[model samples]
Target: MPSYLSPGVYPRETDFSFYVKQISTSSAAMVGVAEKGPINKPTLVTSWEQFLKTFGGYINEGYLAYAARAFFDNGGSVLYVCRVAHYADPTDRNTLSGQKAAAKLVSQMDMYLLNGDPDPLPPQEVYDVFAINEGIWANRLEVQIENVGLSGGTFLLSVIYKGETVERFTDVSSDENATDFVELRVNGVSDYITIHDIWEPVGDTGMGTPRGGTYALSGGENGVVDMADSDYIGDPSQHTGLFAFDEVDALNLLMVPGVTTVPVINAGIGYAESRKDLLFIADAPPMLEPLDVVNFRKGQGTYTHAAFNSSYAALYYPWLEISDPVTAQKKNIPPSGAVAGCCARSDQKTHVWWAPAGIDRGRIFNALTVAYKTSRGERDVLYPEGINTIAVFPDTGINIWGQKTLQSQPSAVDRVNVRRLMMYIEEAISESSRFVVFEPNNPQTWRALGRLINPFLQDIKEKGGLYDYAFQCDEETNTPVVIDRNEMMARVFVKPTKTAEFIELNFILSGTGAVFSELIP
Candidate 1:
C-alpha cells in the first residue's frame, strides 16, 4: 500500500493469477572415471561428440565413456558428468599439481654486456605448457614453437596429439600487456592445453624468445591404480565424487557406472532418500547364475551379509553385451546406464507415471545381447525378489521385463512407477506453493492456494497419473491456534494409478449342440 497525501488521480495494478510451472523429469547425472577432464567437477554434455571433445575418447581402464555413449544412443538429451581420480599425494588434498603432464620452453637467444662481452648465464626457461587435465592421454601430445614475422618477441605455437596437429595459434607474444598474450588467449579458449609465461624481460627488448623446437609433455599419471570405493563415495563436506552432485539442483536420475560395491550402493540409496527428488539406479555383479543372483539378493551364498531394501533405488541384473565402438569387439558392461536411458525415453514418449518396462518402452537400444539369458521360471524367481531382469526374446531382442524397486515389502510404492509418480506430484506442488508463505492466514489465502493446486492435480489425473484426489485448505486445517502461531496448513490425499504387471486368460470347451446364446450367460 502506498500513501498519497494529496492526489487527483491514481493508477494501480495487481496480478491475481498463479499457476504451477512444470519441471523437467528427464535430466540425469553420473559419477565415473574418464580419460581426461576436470576432476571432481560436474560438467554438462549434450552429445557424444561434445563428450569426446571435453573428456577424452574411450579407455580400457573404466566404463565411463561406454556408459555415456549408451546414454546418448538411447534417448537422453542432457547429462551432467563428474569425473573422479585417486589423489597422487593423499596427504595433500589442496592442489592438482603432481597429477598433470607439463613441459617447459627455454630461451634460445644469447645475451651480451654493454662492453661487447659475452654473459655467463645459459639459456633460461620461458613458458610452461600443461595438459588441460590429469590423465596419461596427454603424454602423447607435443608442442612446436616457430618464430613469426621477423620479430623475436612473437611466435606461433602448434599443438600436436598422436602426430596430428590439432590446434595452432599465430602471432602470440610473451608480453603480458599485449592484446595477443599467450596466457590470455589460450588459458580458457584452447581445448587441449594451458600456457604460463615465466620469463623476466630485460630493458625495452623482449629477448627471452623460446627456441624454435618441439617439446614433449611427460609425468602424467591416470591415478586409477589405488582407486577404491571410498574415492567414489567421497566426503560430502569436500564436495568430491558422488557429493559433487550436491551443487546440481534438478537431477532426476543418478548412476555410478561399474562401481557397484555394496557399500557404495548403500551410500547412494541413503543419499537419494535424503534428497527426496531423484532415484538411484543400482547394478548387480556380472555373470551370476539364476540361483546365485537370488542368493545375492537375499544376502546368502557369496554375498553373505549384503542386501538392499529401499523404495528410492532399483536393482538391475545381468550385464549387457554391446559392440565396442573403439576396438570393434563385443564388451560386457553394467545395465544401469542403458536402463537410465530407457527411463528418460519413457518420460519423453509418455508421462513419468507410466511404467518404463515391457516391450514398448524398455527396449535396450545399444546392446546386442544380454550376458545371461533367463527363462520364464528364472524371471518369475528374479522379479519376486525385486530384481528387474533384462531378458532376451526370440524376435523382441533385449527388453526390461520387470519394474520393481528394491523394497522387499509388497505395496503400491514398491513398484517404480508409483514411487516416481508420488515424487513428481510432491515436488511440483511444494515448489509452487512457496508464494503463500508470509501472506495472511485467512480464507482468502487458503482458497488462493486451492485454486492454484486443484488444476495441477486435475491435469495429472486426466493424464492417467491418478485415480482420484482431494484437497482441503481452510479454517479446519488452519485453526485459530495455528493462526496465533502465524502458521498455515493444508492437506492433500491422492490415489496413484498402478501399472498392469500381469494378465490372466481363461479357456473352456463347450459341447457341439450347446446353444451359443445360452453359453454366453
Candidate 2:
C-alpha cells in the first residue's frame, strides 16, 4: 500500500543495518583492504590451481611460466608466488600447479629483453631477435622470452608500463566531434590489442610520394650533415632527423591500391606511446625486383631494385614494435640455448621498442645494455633508459624471407644481397661474379665467429673532402657499379677472411640521423 503523504515527506523503506552485529563481527570482514603501507596490485589470476585449470586447455607442460610471461609483458612489478613443492613431472598438471603456488612473486622486477635466471655464475644470457624487412635484417630487438610457455609464430608483443600512461591517436567516432574515446594502443594490456582504423591506410592513395624526388628527413633542430652527401645517401636535412618528402620514401611503398591485386600489408602494427612519440612498422615488402619502395611520411623518395643494388646498399628493416611476452614457450630458441636470441617470427633478433618522443625520453633495444665506452670514451648504457623507440636496418638478403636453417642464411639477405653487391663490383671489373677462396681455411675463426667476417675487415683511412660516387646500373649487362669517386659520403669495404677471401661492404657513412614516421605518411 502506498503511504499517504501530506506536504511533509514520509519515511522510506530503505533503512540499512550498521550496528546490528557491531560487537560480535569485527570491521575486517566488511572491507578487506589493508590499513596502509605498500599495497599489492590486484592480480587477474588469484589461485595457482585456478590458473592451471584455466590455462591447461591452452597450455602445455608450462603453466606458471606462461602466466609470468603475461605479467612481465604488462609491466608487473612484484610477483608473490607460492611454490608448494619441488616437482620435475613435466606432464603432471596438478604437480606443476602445486609447485608454482608455493613460489612467491618477486617484489622488485627489472624488465629487460634478455634476462636469464640469476642462478650462480651465469654469464649474461643473450636473447636478441631481429626482423626481416625487404629480405634484409633491419629492426633488431634484443630480448629473451624467459619462461617457456606461449604459442609461437609471427607475433608482435607490446608492453605498457604500470607507472606510465599515454593517449592513443584515433578519430572521434561521434557524429558531433566528441572527445570521448581516443584511438590509441600501449605496450601492456589484458590480452587483446586494439588498432585504430584509418582512411587510405598506406600513402598509395592520392597521398603517396612523387616520382624522381627523394625522402625528406626531419632532424632535431640545430643539427647538420654535409649537403653533397645528404642528397646521395637518401638522408634528409631536417632538425628532428625525420625523413620528409613530397611523396613516399620508396623504401615504404605499400601495394598500389585499386589495382585489384591484394594490398600488401605495410606498417603491420602502429603504436603511439605517451612517454614517447608514435611508433610504426611496415611488413616486409614483396620479392619483386625493381620493387617500388615507398616512404610513408615524406610522400617522397621512390626507387627500384636498381637503387638498392648500387646506390643504397646498407639498408634492411629488422625489428618490430610489440608487447613483451613473459612465456618463452614454442618461441625461437637459438642454437646458443638463449631464449631471446632472435625474433619469434624468423629468429634473427628480438627486442622491445619504445617511441622516444621528447628530450626526457629514450627507447630500449636488444643486446645486454652494459656500460660501454662510446667513441668519445665516456661510459653510457649501450642503449639508454627512458628511450621509447629505436630503428635499426640489417644488411642481408633483400629478395626473400624466412629464417636461416642449419644450412643457409635467409636467402633474401644472403643470395640477393650477395649477388646485388657483387654485381656492382663485377661490372666495374672484367670478371663474372665468383666467390674466390685463396687463403688456407681456418676453423678457429669460423668456429669462433661463424660466417660473420666483418670483424676482420681492414680499416680504410678516411680522407675527408667533397668526393663523387654514382650508381652505374647497366640495364644492358645485368650489372651495376657503385663508383666511389674520390670516395665521398660512402666508402668501399672488403672483409677478408680465411674461408671467404674477400667479402664486400659499401658503407654509406653519414652523421647522426634518426628514423621516424613522416607526419605526412
Candidate 3:
C-alpha cells in the first residue's frame, strides 16, 4: 500500500500477469565405474565428446563410457555422470613432489630472523604438474619447462599428451604478482594436470641454474575390483555415488547402467521415488530368460533384493547388441541407457504424458539386435507383470515394444503414460500454486488459483495428454471452517488419455435381402 499526504490525483500502475515456469523433464543422471575422472563428483556433460574429454575413452569391460555414448547417440541432451572408485585402486594422488632448489642470496643477509639479524625463509619448490584424474592415461602426460629468453624470473611451460602438445604457458614467472604466474595460470585452466608447488634452494646454491627439463607423470593404474551397492549408493553426507546427484537441480531419468544387482537396483528405485521428479529405468541382468523375468517381476525370484512395485520405477529386460567404441564389434550391454534416451526423445517429440514405446518413438540407435528373441506369448506374459520389453521388428529395427510401470496393483498408475502424466501435472500445478502460500484466504485468491490452473489443464487436454479435466476451487470447497483454519482446498478431476495397445474389430453377417439403411443402423 502507498500513502499520499497532499495530492489531488495519484497515478499507479500495477501488473498482475504471472505464469508458471515449466520444469525441464529430459535430463538424466547416472553413477558407475570409470577408468578415470573425478571420484564421486557429479559432472554434467551435454555431448558424448564432452564426456570422453572428461572421463576418458571406453575401457575393455567398463559400461559407463559406452552407456554415456549411447545416451547421447539416442537423443539425450543432458547427463550428470558420477564416477565411483575403490580406495585401494592405483592412483596418482601424491605423485607431484618437487625438491627445493637453492636461491641466490648474500650469505650475510640469510641469517635467522629470531634476533632480527636477517629473515631466513627458504622458498619451497613446487611440482610442475600432476594428472587431474587417476588412471594409466596420466602416464601418457609429459610436462616441459624452459627459461624464456634468459629472463631473470620468466619461464615457459608445455604439456604433452600422447606425443602431442595439448597445453602451453609462455613467460610465466615464479613471482606471485606476475601477469602470468606459473601456479595461477596452470592450476585451474589445464585439463591434464595442476601445478603442485614451487620452491628455490637456500643461500645461492642453485640460484642461476635452470631447472628446465621434461618429466613424465607416473603411478596411475586402473583398479581390478567390482563395484558394489555401497559404491553406487554412496554416503549421503559425503554426497558420493547416487547421493552425488543431490547436488544437481533437475533430471527426470536415472540409470545405473552396468550394475544390475538387485540391491543396487532397489536402492536406485527408492532413491528415485524419494526424489519425486524422476523415474528409474532398471536393467535386467544379462542372459535372463523370459521366464526368469516373469518370476522376478512376480516377487518370487531367488534374487536377494526385494521386488519393487511402484510407478517411480520400471524394469527393462534383455541386453542390447551394439558396436563397441573400441572394437566396433557387437557386444551385449544393458538397455537402461537406451531406454532413458527414448524417454527423452518422446518427451520432446510428444508430451511427457505419452509413453515412450512402440515403433514410431521407441526405435533405438546403434543397436544391432537384442540378446533374446521374444515371442508374442512371451510379451503377453511380461507386459502384464510390468516389465517393459525391447523387441526387434521386421522393418523397424530394434524398438521398445512395451510401456508399463512396476505398479501392478491394477490402478491407473499401472500404465506408464498415466503415471507420468500425473507426475507432470502435479509438478506443474505445485510449482505454479507456490505464489498462493501467503495470499489472502478470500474468494479472490481462490479464483486466481483456478484461473492459473484451468488453462494449463486445458492445454494438456488439447495436446491429448488428458481426455478431460475439471478444476474446482469455489466457496463450497473452501468452506468457512477451512477459511478460519488458514487453509484453502481444491478438487481437480482428470481423465488421462490411455494409449491404444490393442484393438478388436468385429464383422457381423446380415441376410442378402436386408435393406442397406437398416443393416447400417
Candidate 4:
C-alpha cells in the first residue's frame, strides 16, 4: 500500500499475469557398480562417451556399463549415474582397504652434522602419488620424475598408463608455497593421479627434490568382493547407493540395473514411493520361465514369500541380449535400463499419458534379442501378474509389450501411463506453486493461485494428458479456520487420460438391400 498527501491523481503498476514453469519429465537416474569413478556420487552424464570417460570402460564384474550404453542407445538423453562399491566399514574411508593404489616418491639427500659427522636419518619422502579413483585400472599406472631447471629445484612429472603417457607436468616444485607446487599442479586437473607434497625443510640440510625414477602404483582393488544387499541400499545419512540420488533435484525414473534381489527391489520401491516423483524400474531375474516369473511376482516358488506392489515401481521380466563391448560375446542383462530409455522417448515423442509399450515407442536399441521369447499364452500369464514383457518378434525385433505397474489391486493407477501422468502433473504443479506460500490468504490471493494453476492443467488437458480438471482455492476449501491456522488450501481434481491397451472392432455383413443407416442404429 502507498499513501499520497494532496495528490489529484496517482499512478500504480500492477502485475496480473502468473504462470507455472514447465518441468522436464524425461531425466533418469541409475545406481550400480562401475569400473572406476567417484563412489556414491550422483554424477550427471549426457552421453555414453562421457560416462565411459568418467566411470571407465565396462568391467566383467558389473552390468553398469552395459546398461548405461543401452540407455543412451535406446534414446535416453540425460542420466545421473551413482557408482556404488563395497567397504569393510562404511563409516571409515580408511577401511576401503586396497581400493586406491599409491606410491611414495622420496628425495635422497646426503646430510652431515656441523661437526662433520654423518646424520643417521634416512631419505625423506617428498611426494605421495595416488590414483585418481579406486579401481584395479590404476594399478597399471606408472609415475616418472626427472630433475629440471638450472638450479635443479623443480622436477618434471609424467604419468603413464600401460606405457602410454597420459599426463605430464613440468617445472613442478616440492615447496608447498611455490606457485608450481606439485599438489597444485596435479591434484584436481590430472585425470590419472593426484600428488601430495610431504617434503619439509630440515634445518641447514640441502633442500630435497623428488628422485628421478619410474614408480608403479600397487595395492589397488576393485572393492566389490562379497558385496551385500546393504551395499546397494547404502546409508541414507551418508547418501550412498540408492540414497545417493538425493543429490539430484529432478529425476523421472530410477534403476538399480541388473540387481534383482528381493531386498534391493523392496528398498528401491520404498525409496521411490517416498520421493513421490520418480518411478523405480525394477528387473526380474534373467532366464526365468513364464511360470517362474509369475510365481516370483506372487511371492511364491524361488522368491518364497516376497512380493512387490507399488504404483511408483514397474517390473520388467526376461533379460535382454546384447553383444558385450568388452567380451565380444552375447550377454543377457536386465531390461530396466532399456525400458527407462523407452519411457524417456515416449515422454519426448508424445505425452507422459501415452503408454511406453507396444511397437512404436517401445523398440529397444543395441539389443539383439530377448533371453526368453515369450509366447502369447505366456504373455497372458505375465501381464496379469504385473510383469512387463520384452517380447521379441520376427517382424518387430524387441519391444516392450506391457505397461502395468507392480500394483496388484486393479485400478486406473495400475497402468504405468496413468501413474506416471499423475506423478508428472502433481510434481510440476507442487513445485511451481511454492511462490504462493507467504502470500495473503484472501480472495485476491485465491484468484491469483487459480490464475496460476488453471492454465497449466488446461495445457495438460489439451495435450491429452488429462480428460478434464478443476481447481479451487477459495473459502469453501480454505475457510476461516484454515486461514487462521496459517494455511492456504487448494483442491485439484483431475481425470487422468487413460491409454487404450485393448481395442475391439465389430464387423457386420448385411444383405445388399439392407440400409446402412438402419444397420448403424
Highest TM-score scorer: 4
- Ordering by lDDT: 4, 1, 3, 2
> Candidate 1, after superposition: displacement of residue 516 in Å?
6.4
**Considering TM-score, which of the candidate structures 3 and 4 is the better prediction for this target?**
4
Q: Candidate 1: where is the Cα deviation over 4 Å?
A: 1-12, 88-92, 95-98, 112-120, 149-152, 511-521
Per-model root-mean-square deviation over C-alphas: 2.5, 34.8, 5.8, 2.1
C-alpha lDDT score of every prediction, in listed order: 0.85, 0.19, 0.77, 0.85
Backbone clash total for model 1 is 0
Please write out the lDDT profile of model 3 over residues 190-237, one tens digit for every residue.
Answer: 888777444444434234223576767776665425544677776676
- Worst 10 contiguous positions by lDDT, candidate 1: 89-98
Q: What is the lDDT of residue 253 in candidate 3?
A: 87
TM-score of model 2 (CA atoms): 0.15
Looking at model 1, residue 2 earns an lDDT score of 79
Flag regions of model 3 displaced more than 4 Å. 4-7, 87-125, 148-151, 198-210, 222-226, 474-487, 507-517
Give one digit per residue, the lDDT tens place, for model 2 in 88-176: 23223232111000101110112233467554332221111111111001111111112221221111222122222222222212111
Question: How many clashes (backbone N, Cα, C below 3 Å) per candidate?
Answer: 0, 110, 11, 0
Higher-ranked by lDDT: 1 or 2: 1
Instruction: State the RMSD for candidate 1.
Output: 2.5
How much is 329 displaced in model 3, in angstroms? Answer: 2.6
